[model samples]
Target chain A: MIFDTTAIAAMDKLQRVQFATTLPGPKPLCLVGTRSLAGRSNLAPFSSVTHLGSNPILIGMVTRPDTVERHTLRNILETQSWTLNHVTEEFVAQAHQCSARYPEETSEFEATGLTEHHHPSITAPFVLESPIRFALKLEEIIDITSNNTKLVVGRVCFVEIPDESYSPDGTVDISRSLASTALDTYFSIQEVSRLPYAKPAPPTP
Target chain B: MIFDTTAIAAMDKLQRVQFATTLPGPKPLCLVGTRSLAGRSNLAPFSSVTHLGSNPILIGMVTRPDTVERHTLRNILETQSWTLNHVTEEFVAQAHQCSARYPEETSEFEATGLTEHHHPSITAPFVLESPIRFALKLEEIIDITSNNTKLVVGRVCFVEIPDESYSPDGTVDISRSLASTALDTYFSIQEVSRLPYAKPAPPTP
Candidate 1:
């Protein structure tokens, strides 16, 4: 079926959400770790993470205006420090539990029983169960005026990956990474093939 | 292994690209279609598409400073309209071929042999081979000053999905949708399980 703007607006609230969120297809699932000024740590699952650049190693993620995820946005804006831990099948359930609307005083690390680890100087926590992770410092927050959502941009200050996953060419083989299609549906990725960089073929007749 | 910012900066250029791009994990794959005001059409593969909101149905994508993708950015800027077509395993080879630096006058549709279909009143072309697609209108472009990239945001004006893949709850079971890690690696997703809406458990005693 096809849905135009008017038809989409007429969709049931929850239905529109499921449809719109998954329309972009599977997203990169990561557990964002942040710390409040009071020293309380926060962990939230986000699938909006996108690679913004490589030279400065920038990443961007979106946060809804009216969700507990705002806590993460607020913490990042205030502390300017956070961590992105890639969720794998082994701990996806625990990572998904971090989405629960726990009170501000609650640390998802404790609430969800996931071990929180810390790098040398960064204050934000990292998931011990996550095989690939990054320590990041906030750079900018772009507001999506149409919807009150914000795109949080960060510069990678530190990086971590398992030796096995890290390749000599610098590609991290995260085939074991778990992905989400919608809010509730989860999937595991299997690398089918890796193609060479494309070079345009001679003009077709 | 771990690398600090300084260490990351010292790495080889191509290695850095692979490392930083895949740092966020697998990304949603889509063929972004746009039409220049001059009447030339363009198609390019993008892995940056991310859901920014649902109510107004916003999606965000990132574009590098120097690449053929700039054609996509320029067309959207000039025409204010575009289409995002999800890539599936069947046509991934053709979709990946879109990344080839075809001349602005060449439509990837013809070069790659993928059929392009248009919706009435919308000039942007949609991939007829794609199972899920969206007609989008340019909303805003936020410049990533840190690295000179731009975050292109668009509002969904229309949506089309396969009847069999779309569920009653509005979820699109794009388990067949292809995902990419780094630059060349592609993966297929398998829906493992769908969890219920998470709610915070009663405060532990």
Candidate 2:
């Protein structure tokens, strides 16, 4: 059933959301992440993080569009960098608490109980608590027009995952970490199906 | 945790990829939508379609760069109009199949056996199969990067949803539609948790 952009458009206000709100969702365990400016540590949970591309490795987040000058957007703009850590169900609660919207001047690292680590290649800090994390360079801050939303795109520069998560061929098994999702009125993840890669075209003949 | 630009910038790619790949497995659903071009029908699937804003109502999609000149992108560019339709779990199979790369001259409506409709407000065709859809006008297109991705942003000119999908408080209950996430290699969506709109602050009786 093909839907047109208009009919698709008519589907209610599902998109233009600020900081995509989720419920008691499935959070990664040990939501270990860090935040900072210049070179300080500010550990935090980034539940709003999302993926935008795979080729060059891009990630995104809908930030609090600042009519004012100070915020995550400003920090990204000023520093031109950021990082995301994958927390397993082991620490999602801690990750949620990371949503503490700390004052701009404070560091989440000192604020949250999570530990911090430094990336070897990039200057960013990462959540030592998180088994996995990645550094990213701010690519753009799209001034989204809907309600007051800003789409922030980042280029993933580095990544860190526990050795067990991905197989040699890049097959990731998230069963180890408690992951999550965003629904209209809730945040949950219920298994629907398991589809393998379209069976490799049945041996091509 | 407040992760900083420098701190966030140093994490690794594998770590970052796992964090950004939100849904663990197969959410075999695509909102089938249509658009009419020069009185013809066009059908396409966009897992990348996520609302970027909501005030004036903006919709955006992170399209796969383009092979042979981006059909939907070109259509929207030419007509300055397009639509979005909600695809349910029922039609996800057909929706995923529509993503087959057809040449610029090919119409997906024919390849995937979809119906098409046109709106009076915009010249682009839309999917008649969709129970709900919306027409839109292009607002902006930002190049997220040089690799192979483009964010197509548009203004919601019109919208349509089933009566059941909407809540009383001006929100769209879009959970009924299927979702897809890039796992190590598959796509899946689960019913994670209910959305939790924050309740009012407690009164200081």
Candidate 3:
């Protein structure tokens, strides 16, 4: 049977979906800022982080398209750099505390009772409590026409990975990281398995 | 905290994971011709499915760099139109079966025990069992870089959305259809939520 435009259009519409991840992780991120219009510090939990490309090592996350009060967005736009810290299973409670809406001067780390660590190469501050952390610089920002979000693409600059979580190929095993998801609900990544890699190709003709 | 490239790169390499998906969902696709080609099909998946312009109902997908025997590539190239099928939970079984190494003359649809619905608008065959499908014409094919996989942009000739899956905005809810990752791993969409939308800005300030 052959398919025409009619059938093609039908399925395309059905595949559209919306994504909103607001859940906090186990560890809180102390988004340390050296320069901000409002000054001092801010901490927030974001789960939209994703890698877009490898050649340039591009990482992206969706942010408020028209955020009137996105201090993080202001910081990224101002300093053009931001550090991403993963909240492990142990820091879930502390990570949640940093998410509180607070005055710019009120340090979320102090307010949430979490400690902060300075990145060795970059000027941004990181959460010493986070088992995994990475620093990045803003590369490009693409506003998708289909969604009300800004796809913030950045370049990775520096990183700190717990020794226990490291692999030979440089992949992080998620089993022990204590990662969580904000899929309209909270979930943890406990047991992960690797399967045969069906390398991209059709069976030889 | 601000992120630099080094740190960001480290995290991606560290967290790199392998996916296990043989389910019926999006796979590699392309447009090949029946001219001198021994088979009447192409193989590959479209990762860049997007609305080029709603007025004309143009849809596009990027067929990044490939170096293999892909039926989707030749079929679209030989013929102007190709059928885009959505890999569904039900049909992914047969779809994956179609991906097996078979003779060029071997009709994947027939071997996999799946039904292909013919499209009248074009001469392509769509997967009837798929929750979503589309028939499109080759509007353009651009290689992002020399010697890289080409980005096959198609002008949606037609579409099909399941009756129960259609939403109020003419979009269908995909959670019912299930989403898969194209990376080495394929993850079933675990959840879905709503967000108003984000505003946009270009690459340049």
Q: Would you list the C-alpha lDDT of every candidate in the order shown? A: 0.89, 0.52, 0.47
Q: DockQ (C-alpha) of model 2? A: 0.20
Candidate 2 to truth, TM = 0.69
**What TM-score do all the candidates reach, one by one?**
0.97, 0.69, 0.53
Model 1 residue B81 lDDT score: 97
Candidate number that wins on DockQ, 1 or 2: 1
- Per-residue accuracy of model 1 over A1-205 as CA lDDT, tens digit each: 8889998899899998999888988888999999988899999999989988888888888898789898998899789999999988888888889999999998999998999998878989999999988999998888777677888889999988888888888888798888886788788988888999998897549
State the lDDT of candidate 3 residue by residue for B1-205, as single tens digits.
Answer: 3224444344443243221111111222221212114436433333334333433354445443332235566666777677666554554444444434455666665556566576555677767676566666777665433224444556655656566755444444444332333333222432222222322212356
Instruction: Order the numbered candidates by DockQ, best leading.
Output: 1, 2, 3
Worst 10 residues of 2 chain A by lDDT: A18-27
On the 0 to 100 scale, the lDDT of residue A32 in model 3 is: 30
lDDT per residue for candidate 3 within A83-152, as digits (tens), equals 7776555666656545555666667667777777775566566778876676777776664443334556
| Most accurate candidate by lDDT | 1
